[model samples]
Target: MMRRQFFLLPLMINALMACLAMALTNITTDQHALLAFKSQLKLDPSHILSKNWSVSFPTGKWIGVTCSPRHQRVSALDVSGMRLSGNLPSQLGNLSFLASLNLSSNSFHGQLPKELAQLHRLRYLDFRLNGLTGDIPFWLGLLVELRFLNLRNNSFTGTIPSSITNMSKLQVLDLSNNPLQGNIPEAVGSLFNFYP
Candidate 1:
């Protein structure tokens, strides 16, 4: 019995260490994605993230960053209205655990990076008041967890894709003030039961 207990104790310790290593890897991955995003910005007038994103600050303590308590992975990033200008980088797709993101009221331009569709866990996204162009990517429908999406006042053209109906979890979808034409999809009825 003594020998059996000794072996089992080491096994448990090794398993615990492996889990800690994985958690650390996840935290580092989130930091790398955030740093990659900062590198692409043309300007950060408020110096929010630019000044605060450092290892010494801890991933969860960084400005506009929020991490999952259990996994220690960035889950929400809200950096709205800091007069930032830059193209959205594909590296953002690396934040696999991201659930809520808000980059509204910035001057970001160019097409939305297709890599954004990699965020399968995303629940809330607000990119309003930017200069983003191109048609809203139909791939957004693949984000089955998405709930609130606000793309108001952007330069996006073309009609909303019918694939958007696949967002059965979507509760509030704001696509107002774009150059979009054509009628809303009929399948949208499944999303909201009441509408005024």
Candidate 2:
């Protein structure tokens, strides 16, 4: 009996360690995503992400990070009013669990990345007051969970993609202040409470 117990103890310990490792990987991936954003986007030298990003603690303690208790990974990133300038990186799409991303009131330029469509869990995306240009990617409609989308005050041009109407859960849609032309697609009315 003593010999059997010893063997079982090691197995249990190994399993516990595996679970802990998996949790740590998730946290690391989430943090890496935020770091990638900081590197790709030109941020104001006066205001920057926390330098102590290696420490583990409540996400609220970290600048621009928000996490949920159920899953200790980052859920939201609000970097508004930071006076940031630069183009977004395509690598941002790697964040599979991001829910809200707010980078408003910055000076970011370049075309909106098609990679952004990969954020399946994203619900709120605000890129307002930037210099982003080009057609709205059709893949954006694939974000079925999206509820709030604001791309206002940008240099975006071209007809709004008809696929945007597929965002059935969307409650607020603000594309005003861009150079977009052409009649608004009829399907846009389908979004429950979408407003200009």
Candidate 3:
């Protein structure tokens, strides 16, 4: 009986280990998404996220990162006002779980990456006060969860995509300072009038 119990103990331990491994895998994927975003964006020069960055266990407490409890997945990335310069990285799209992304008040210049449309969970995106220019990617309308979108004080130009109307959850839309032209989408006026 002692030998039989010993054999069963190993089987149970192996099963438990397998379950733990699966959970860790899911957590790692989430963490990777956040880390990828951090790596893609340009950071400040004060060694803030400059060196010794780790996305696992107790290390994420460094700076410019906010993570969840259990899996340590990043939820918000607020790297605003850092004067950082670089093109918005396409890798940012990997952060599908991000709720808020604030790269405002920086020197970032480039067309908005189309991949950003993949952020289905993003609620607030503030790219105002940057140097971003080009036709606003129509893909942005795909962000169904977005509420506050501030692209003010930038160089974005071209007709406002009618797709902007797809953002049903949007509450605050500030494009006042951009170079966008053309008649405002009628759907937008019907849904929420900005002018009396």
Candidate 4:
């Protein structure tokens, strides 16, 4: 029994090391993605993210960042109304655990990054009051778990995609103040929670 226990100790230690490595890697991915986003910003009027987002600090402790207690991964990022101006970076899609993202009342422009479709865990997304252009990507429908989506007061054109009907869980969808034409999709009537 002593010999068996001795051999098991090494195996247990190796397993613990592997778990720790995985946990670090997960948080590192979130850090790298956020840094990439900050690098692309054209303006940070108050240097909120400029100074706060650094390798020296834990991401969860950063201003406007929220991490899940169980996973220690970034789960929510609300940088609304900081006067930030930039193109949305594709690296944001790397925040695999992100559930709520609010970038409203900023100066961000450019089209929505298609990579964002990877955020299957997203529940609340608000991009209102920006200069974002281009058609709302149909891939947004892939976020089946999304509950609230606010894209009001943008420059997005084209008709609302019928694919949005896939978001059965969606409760609030505000697409007001755009230049979009065409009627709302008939299939959207099935979503009882949708308020348009």
What is the per-residue lDDT of model 4 for residues 41-155, given as tens digits with 9 covering 90 to 100? 9999899898999999999989999999999999999999999999999999999999999999999999999999999999999999999999988999999999999999999
The collision pairs in model 1 are none
Clashes of each: 0, 0, 0, 0
Model 3 lDDT tens row, 132-188: 999887888899788888899999999888888888878888887888889877887
Error of 2 at 41 (Å): 3.2
Instruction: Please report how far candidate 3 places residue 68 from its true position, in Å.
Output: 2.6
* Alpha-carbon runs more than 4 Å astray in model 3: 1-43, 55-59, 192-196
Question: What's the true lDDT of residue 79 in model 2?
Answer: 83
Candidate 3 — which pairs collide? none
- Residue 78, candidate 3: C-alpha displacement in angstroms: 0.6
Q: Which consecutive 10 residues in model 1 have the weakest lDDT in total?
A: 187-196
- Give the Cα RMSD of candidate 4: 1.6
Q: Among these predicted structures, which one has the highest lDDT?
A: 4
- The model with the greatest TM-score is 4
Q: What is the lDDT of residue 11 in candidate 4?
A: 100
TM-score-better candidate, 2 vs 3: 2
Candidate 1 TM-score to native: 0.87
- Which candidate, 2 or 4, has the higher lDDT? 4
Local distance difference test, each candidate: 0.89, 0.83, 0.77, 0.94
List the candidate numbers ranked by lDDT, top first.
4, 1, 2, 3
